[model samples]
Target: MRKNEYTKNYDITIVGGGLAGKLMLAVLINCGVFDQDKLCWINTDNENFKDVRVSFINYKNFIKLKKRIQLDVYSKDYSVIEKIELHNTNEKYPLKLKDLNNHGIIIRNDILKQNIKFSEKKIDIYRSKVISTKCDEFNRYLFLKDGTKIKSALVISADGSLSPLRELCKIKYLNNNLNHTIITGYLECKNFNNSTAKQIFLKDNFIGLLPLNDEKNLINFVWSIDNKILDTNKINFHEKIIQMLNKFFLKNNLIFDSPKSKDDKFKRVQTYPINVKFVNIPFKERIILIGDAAHTIHPLAGQGFNLSIEDCFDMVKCLKNAKIIGKDFGTLSLLKTYNNIRKTRKNFITLATTLIFYVFSKKNNQLNNIINYGIEKIEKTSLKEIFKFLAKGY
Candidate 1:
């Protein structure tokens, strides 16, 4: 038992083995605060991680990290999203936001995992569940289901939305339930261009077509269904998509039958209600929450994953600063620095998505006029660069 105790102790312990947690581990490795024995990862072994969902990666931020810290996130496997075209009902002008640097990439979850996992092989990995946690002033202790206790000076929770570590810290969130159900699935289309993604605003909800590959045939689709329009449990995705698009999008692109072989990944579908939340402060005592544990946003912008990456990088920055001063990085005072930065970013992103969602959902003449003015301002003025920065994280 003494040997077990010695093996389990660490300077930092990170929970949640998802992309956020792994990214945190990778950045911390780059920060050079702790070596192999001092840092550890606790994976939620219960999850097989259904990786059908795709994410919008801000390549500028990723490439910055890749260049500075040697992350392998940029490669030929990703599909570039050079432009985003937004459309609405009744002769609406598509709001076009262009990135001159081509800073956005739409990549599935699994490939992204491969890109970030290269440097994490040196750390101690625990494939167990954290059942309970206790903390003193200098260190937090995690009791795992696998009969081990981990003592760490700092605990970073990159766990999922329902983070057990956040609950233990007693952090509260600002909540907004959009009351819309989103259906995500792959669509096989004829001559689907992977360079430009499109969003169509219908009378009720919006549809997002995110490019998936260079072949230009497969696209990841996010269709939000207003609760009043249909039951979430009873969605027949392909038929409903055909019905939804034939009215507004027929001439723009053609969607064909998705490949439905058992091995065909495109046939998988995931449905979840849209809810947005943000923590006022995502840190307490010696623990900090990053990624989905810290905030949730409307998926229209596809900024959630990129925001998570920003969170991890910022947390590492705080830790590195604290280390340079020979101070405890786990202290609540030091963590407040990270808290302020991420909260501001989280607020700005959440509010932007909320505005876009509101303008589309409300569908009033006033809101329509407001969006039109905003889009025109973006196109005609230098605000276009700022808009691109906000959308693509340049």
Candidate 2:
């Protein structure tokens, strides 16, 4: 079918059903932008829709989500995180979350999906991949793989790093692959206390323990090793992982328990190269990109999802205010405001995460000693507040 052949016209068509897209839909509905008949959500996958990727949401985002979305429903699948702990492999000093007088919440990607489902907005979900998108003088058209098309006043591309829509729209981006791999999975560890998140920095890689429900834990293992280490057939990756984890837990003197056999919920470790990118412009004509479509950052600090949610909130606020003032909400000038607000913040986070990775990834004796002393001083002083400010998505 031709790109403009679809019959349905939407006010806003979101091009991904991930956290960012769903949050944007919920925000529009909450703002009463349009009744349940104006939005279309498109995606290709039909899995639980919850990203195994976990996010540590700050206090501000927690308040916004509670006020604007369905928190009760989200809580069923996520955890309200009250604390976080950061450890340096060279020392015993650790930074604890309670020192900052702030708490972060953890939510699964699927929980966000459920929250968006509660919106009264008229949202239609299309189970087809977006093949291409085009903008003409009046409207934006998204061509789907199922021989269908959607036209909308505004098309928000939340389709992530390999965004087809962004490519189709010709949005220029700065891309860099950091030559790292992040392996994420869930483990059931006893006596986790459900209150603290732990991050351990080792010479070769990093391991983060995010406590979910009472007994379940989410682990993100990041390694900055040579790319050859990721070759599936050439390396005994699973055995290597077990060895790493064993040494990690042994160093920390923390007991490790295998996942429950009944639960057997563990899947083969998934590996993805870490890439960072920032769009020169997130909006063009009637097309705009949000979340990973606009920028992708290092996951070291777990700020990607929070940043995406903030983008959704900011876009809704700007558009709503423009509509109330009788301004052209869909115009490039107005859309540029959204990009401007998000770009600086995203860049700061991207740079900060990169710096953190560089500092801790060093194994030099002098740098390690300096890091150990810094950690000790941080634990003894108010420096933790600064760390929390960065981690809490300020």
Candidate 3:
């Protein structure tokens, strides 16, 4: 048996250093829960992140974070989205989402990672992998690969979809691959303003173009198509997509100017298999899962990241209350409250998005017409409610 050569203790240990994890750390630091030295963050590697990954934060969620955390340090650098335009294959008129108060802000993941400069001074960040975990009645312990161990009163797992700590807890869950492929990349565009987030629904695929910065010269594009159409040869896929988009824009009388070139390059075209996953219960013993670790949903509604943001805020609230009441912050009562609040919203969002995919994916002409008509009616009559739901995530 090995002796404990190095042992450290913290009030809270955060596993995973993704956006959600960082937001939690920032909140803890801002809320004055514990000094930076009293908290620990265990991450495998901080340098292995993509600068291209992005998310759209609803106005309400943005305000919430900005008011609580020091988000202004980096959030103001992104593009503010004022409108959302949705298109269908059969119609020339698009469904427009423009709310004066409930808009979205486009932000890059890299910027968010960099904005945490303020918190770097306080938290004990370990750049090592968690080899295993051990827990007792009162505290939880993490074993790192470098033969170091750390203990904490509460452990938060924001470790993305494939969380090792979640596995160690033996938490039963449901995971299903939808057999769809999502191709995401950045593209240069002309005749586009940075005020709108657009999604065009075609017969076989859905394309989302989000403004990356204020100039709107570059767009972050995500295309969700059938998995079978993915070609590994990389043969003129970029050209074909540009041509198709220009044609669609012309049909809709939208300005889509492209410079005629003999060779055009696409940056970082990556494919991911779409999946729906969530745990049955979010906590085991002293550990609680949040963000993607607890639930993941389809991108059809662009609510995955927003939901994760909300998760952080809600968790902070619950933990603060637990502290105020002088109760063990890691108690089952506190965790159950967090799980109940998140799971209810998660279920509602999952059902809504799944039904939407079903309705839009149907190939029957009559069903398509009916769905389009329904959407148009909703847009005209209840558009504000829709925008509110998307913005506030109720």
Candidate 4:
């Protein structure tokens, strides 16, 4: 990987080969929308299992991507969630939501990456860091840390939230530090059927118990708590978590048995302060941002990756249209269609998830009553509609 050894030019260059970038590349290659040889992808990490362990993918979105890439929907690696149960710390009864036609799929993050088919013969993948980027009216140049310079008509940033390209583009955005730290890991439990997704809204924290695979014995949990609490006690966090799970399930009269301390498989406990970040426009100049680089929401809703896929899907359509019409894919007008189509929907989701987090974080009697009343009023129609919206994004 010598820098001055060679120079390459591509029709499109995608930065950050995480799930979003890889999926986008897979779709583009499979769709035949772009010349496979002309597309370039860059990744710092070679698709290793990062902090993200699992994701809850709605059925419709899964199907959509599967059709585009011809992935089998009934893969053994994915676990189906027939129902979702939501409980408040003070409420005796939990709110259950389900859709008959569609269900959520819990998938290991690394497995999804492994399934993506990108032949090295078709795609030019550079496993080097981007050292610098220079753009002009016609083309954008990407300087890799290895000194290989790449020229492309369009540069896409699928990088994470702390995207250097997002900052380099001089795009102004609102970044909020939620002051909440999230602890995510897996647990092995007994007598728990993997048919349902469970969420508990505690006073100071929010917990999600999503099943992994078909066996249903393993639960992937995400615990979002106040930073102050995490700061106070760094030791025995998982031990305390096991106690809480046992207590909560027992108190709630759940059918599942308590988590076993000795048999539990602990991968790694990770913590990071939550942030609600959004860019007014996801594209600037010849660069477009997708995935976390564009917008990041709270994990409680499980829409972060879904939203990224939606954005990438729409961007694909835009590029196809531009190709059909003999227009530059990097044209602002062409990119604007994607931004306009996604911004409002993304805004609504961001706002909705943030509001839900706020409402559930504290015990507000009036807000709770209003939520309950609204849920009761729209329970039948809205749940189905919401699930479809989340699943299909239509």
Candidate 5:
């Protein structure tokens, strides 16, 4: 069958309608670049409108979101975080986010999606998968699974880490698989408040509890142990999680009321390898990549969404400038400018997070001493300012 053709082509076609794609649409439309008729968005995931994963928005990024999209309505279901607490299982020292002057916000993915849905002025969203994409000298072709093809001046790939468009474009990436798994779930605690986020670093693992509305909280447990410990056939995952939680609470002398009923209604966990990688070139010819399609970092600092948003910001800025100069938006020169501006910041974040993981993952006495001393110095210094700057997407 001849692929369905678009006689009236769009100026730009974006793949993947996740947070990154949606945000880009908002930025471009709000900037008055293209109305609904000129922008096309292709998304394959149709089961749910948003992802369940949560993201923490720092002050700086929050401002950008407000300016780029309608945020007042989205803030209704989100939680504002005033402090973050970090503890070492074997040590007495703990760090708190109150040391930092500014606070962050914890938002569910659904809220973000809803906000975008409300803010989008005139953008076409296609609920179909992109099977293949090719670029020639003049126009880029995107072939959808449903026998439709779109020819546009530029194509943006925000599909994510294992992007089909990036693969089709033959882009190379550097991958670092940490061989670790993070298990996350929601817990109902009687005494857990919504004002603080907590992280407990243990000998072989770490636990992060982020408070949501009411008495509910989200728990992210990251274990660096061998994957064999998770027995799929016989072991009860919830019981194991509860046991670990109790052990940590007991060890730290923290108090919390037991569940009203133990029916396992709030028990769910997913285990996946932590991988980080970056594309050598984020753009080529009439094709460009953003968000996880361009790079993915460890989730330790919860900066993945922030980085993706920043990517959209930079790309939109570059495109706006290109338009002013009457230059092609997808040219290598424009993309190189965007890449050069973002690569240094991305490298710095990747290295910093990796260093933190390495230092905390070790159990040697000398390293522990060094970490302890470092923590003491950080507690006394203005490191939170530096951290806030990075977290706020400086």
Candidate 6:
């Protein structure tokens, strides 16, 4: 790889081959909106994050992505969640949230990451890291670490939260430290069925329990712990978690069962820090940021993957519209259209997640108040149906 070898392929170069990049590439290749020769993928692989053991994508999004993109093996790597239950430390019992005419899906992150590699696509692949970028009116030059320079009409920066291309583009972004970290893993239990997904907002942390299988009896647990608590006790945290969870259930008069056998235990444990980042505009010039490069919200709401999916899906739609009209998809006006379409939704989600985290983190009368209000509204008004409609994208 000599620096003199500057010639490279490029019509649209996607930088970052993680889920979002791979996903968009899959759609673009399958949909034939652009010629296969016009598309190239840079950094065709990424670190396999073991911390994200399982991820939840709502049923609506799942079906839409699968149908629209003809996703690679999407149906094979997931388990269904027939129902959802929500609980707060202040509440006596869990409140069941009505499904939006369909259920949700829990995907094994490893399986999906392993299977959706876009191996069949014939586009040019660059495993080199993007070292520098130069933008002009018609083309953007991407300098790679391996001495290959690509000139792309459009560049997609899906390289993740700390995106090198984003930095190179001089895109200003805001970062909000959540002051929390999540410990995610699997816990095997014999008594529980995999029909329901549950979330509990505790004082110092929030816990999400997603059943992995109906017959195998395993639950994927995502525990968001306060930094202070996590820093104070670095030993035997999972053991204490079980005890604390059982006590919460008992005190709330909720039926609970603890795993009694060695076969039924916590395993595959991992922890990671949490933060939220956002850019006001997801695009600058002809380079666009998708997935974590554009934004990363609180994971408590399970909106991370969904938002990324929307980013990819909407991007394709924008390009498709451009293709239909015989317009340049890499133009600034087109990028603005894409940014405008995605901005408000990202803002709303970011605000909502931050607000929810604030309310739950305080654990004051606010928790009880929300629970009571929710119960009353569900019983007395049509708020329940309204929420269902919202969930279903009405």
lDDT of 3 by residue, 65-111 (tens): 67887576444468888888888878747888778664878877777
Backbone clashes under 3 angstroms, per model: 0, 4, 1, 1, 1, 0
Which pairs of residues clash in candidate 4, taking residues 3 or more apart in a chain or in different chains?
Answer: 3-147
Tens-digit lDDT string for candidate 1 (1-394): 6525735557789998888898888788876675667888998644555586888778677676666567565556678878888777754467787776775788888777766743656777888888888888779888888877888889999887778878777888877888898888877666667888888788777889887774547778898878888654475788778677666766666645565445556687788877887788788778888888888887888888889988887888788888788887688887888888777778888888888788789878777677777776667888777657677673
Model 4: how far residue 379 lies from native, Å = 4.3
Per-residue lDDT of candidate 5, residues 1-394 (tens digit): 2556553577788898778887787777777765468788886666454455567777677778787764664344667777777777556567766634446777767766667643444666677798887778777988777878788888888998788888888888888876556766555555555767767666656666766554344433433332445443355555665666677677555544323434353344556677777687777778889988888877667777888888888888888898888887667788789889899878777777777677677657777777667777887888756655555567
Residue range 1-394, candidate 6, lDDT tens digits: 4566555546688888777788778777767668787788886465655434777777788777667765455444567777677677656456666674565678777666665544455688888889999988878889888788888889988999888888898999998998998887766555555667778888887988887653556677788999999889865756766766777667545333333335423454778788889799878888999998899877776777778888887888898899899887689989999988999778877777788788778757766677656765575567665434333431
Clashing pairs in 5: 36-122
Across 214-325, the per-residue lDDT of candidate 2 in tens digits comes to 3344443343443544553375554565566567667456544445545334444556778888777887889889988887887777888888988988898888878788
Worst 10 residues of 4 by lDDT: 256-265
Clashing pairs in 2: 36-121, 36-122, 37-122, 50-110
Q: Give the Cα-based TM-score of candidate 5 against the true structure.
A: 0.89
User: Roughly what TM-score does model 2 have, to 2 decimal places?
Assistant: 0.89
CA lDDT for candidate 5: 0.70
Give me the displacement of residue 239 in model 2, in angstroms: 4.8
Better of 1 and 2 by lDDT: 1
Residue-level lDDT of model 4, residues 187-265, one tens digit each, is 7676566778878887677888888764547678888997777778865656767777777788645443334445334
Where is model 3 more than 4 Å wrong at Cα? 1-6, 48-50, 73-76, 214-216, 231-235, 253-266
Write out the backbone clash pairs for model 6: none
RMSD of 2: 2.9
